[model samples]
Target: MASHSLSAVRKRRRRRAKTLLVMVGLLLLTGAGGYLALLNLEPSEAVMRERCTAVVGTETYDLNPDQASNAALIAGVALRRGLPPRAASIAIATAIQESGLRNLDYGDDAGPDSRGLFQQRPSQGWGTQAQVMDPIYAANAFYDGLLKVPGYTNMPITEAAQAVQISAFPEAYADHEPEARAFASALTGYSAASLDCMLRSAESPGDPSQVAAAAAAVFGNQSVVVNESTVTLQAVDRAGWATAQWAVANAKQLNLTSVSFGGLQWDRVGGWTSAETEPGTVTLNVAGAVVE
Candidate 1:
């Protein structure tokens, strides 16, 4: 009787052990399946590539890559200045005329007093030599004075710039307006992605990531990501879901990630990650600072 009882106890233990092993295997399989689903959830690369191509072909001026980059810089500066798309267009057109969007180290004799991207004169109250050289500051100053002029927006590009710049060669800005308008139209939408550089160069002082964060603060928790060489931002609605289907849809132009909705609030969870630890899974929380 004692031997039979012992045999039954051993059989129960073996069954429990087998059951536990099966459960663990099932759990691991489920976890792996979930991860694969997440990976597959990312937007199609081919689609993104096509969209990027369209943006480059349509929005950019016929100038070479250097000129396109310069145009983007000017647009970014104008956007930072809180200028409307029209105002940015006018500014770019003026720069195209003044320096062909190239930041010339030397000023032409026609405007020896002219300098920097906009060619504002230091002798004029535009600013000290240092201030005018800084594109953001100079552009903001120009827009500030430009906005104060009566009917500046309604006036021609030359008139608008001359109202602020008081340039002797007022008509020089007129020819550049069409190119500027083309740039503005391409960059002002929600679906409009980041402007690409024909030539890669050193990073600018005004990084687009910082700009996107500022825009998000005013606009709500929009998704910002660095894709290829461009910084993309997607606009989200009150629920934080992406409102546009693609990057070329809205007027507040920025690159964007594929839309995600109904997931755990990613912002609260923190930024994305590829870790396997608990609490390290992809969540919306802001990324924590790393130690040096």
Candidate 2:
């Protein structure tokens, strides 16, 4: 009887070991499969980030897509209205102070009625809340007030901005002068090849109507052309670069793959290239974009 019991015990231990081995094998296989799945996923399947930069001389300014886009519009509007580079700098500084270059519809307890990029108070004749929310309108309104300050272009940025903004924190605008200057120089075409954006993923493609409207909203009527596969803009030399760079600044959002003018072209993977192209018109090629 003792011998028989020993044999049975040995058999039971062998069976348990086999079962544990099978489980360990299964676990290893499962882990390997999961890791392989992760490796197979596309880069764009993950949330991708976009960035823009303005490099001028020895200075560089980096900003997110939204901030870059807004900065472009602010400076573009300044150019469209014949505002000097100094005016653009002061405007950009003021925007940096008020809303961090974003258009906001709310304000602090002191000026709860204040709104827009410049934090203009609707109750204080800055126009309707809706107008204040419009970046172009608000920028124009800011310029209107800014122009009223005598020789604002020649005044110190903080003092000029203070006269227009009348902020309780008047000196805050001074801190952003360097960054604002870099962005303004690039967007206003005073600094060539100074601005660019690295888009991490392909975005929704460009829309003809929307592109035209967006450009018109800032540059004012007929500065850009609406087309099925292209949006042409009337840019002369550096002005062309300003618009091309603006398209690049908006590439991620607009799914812009190509911005071409003169003998140069900017594409998604490779940046600017020397491509033979027509003069007098800057063509932005809109291929493989989501039209929405």
Please provide, for model 2 over 176-267, each residue's C-alpha lDDT reduced to its tens digit, 9 standing for 90 to 100. Answer: 99999998888888876677776643545467677777777877765666778788988787677777777777776676777787687877
**Model 2's lDDT to the true fold?**
0.79
TM-score of each: 0.50, 0.81
Q: Report how far off residue 35 is in candidate 2 (Å).
A: 15
Across 122-188, the per-residue lDDT of candidate 1 in tens digits comes to 8877787788777656667777887798877788888887777666688988887866776654444
Clash totals, every prediction: 20, 2
Best candidate, lDDT: 2
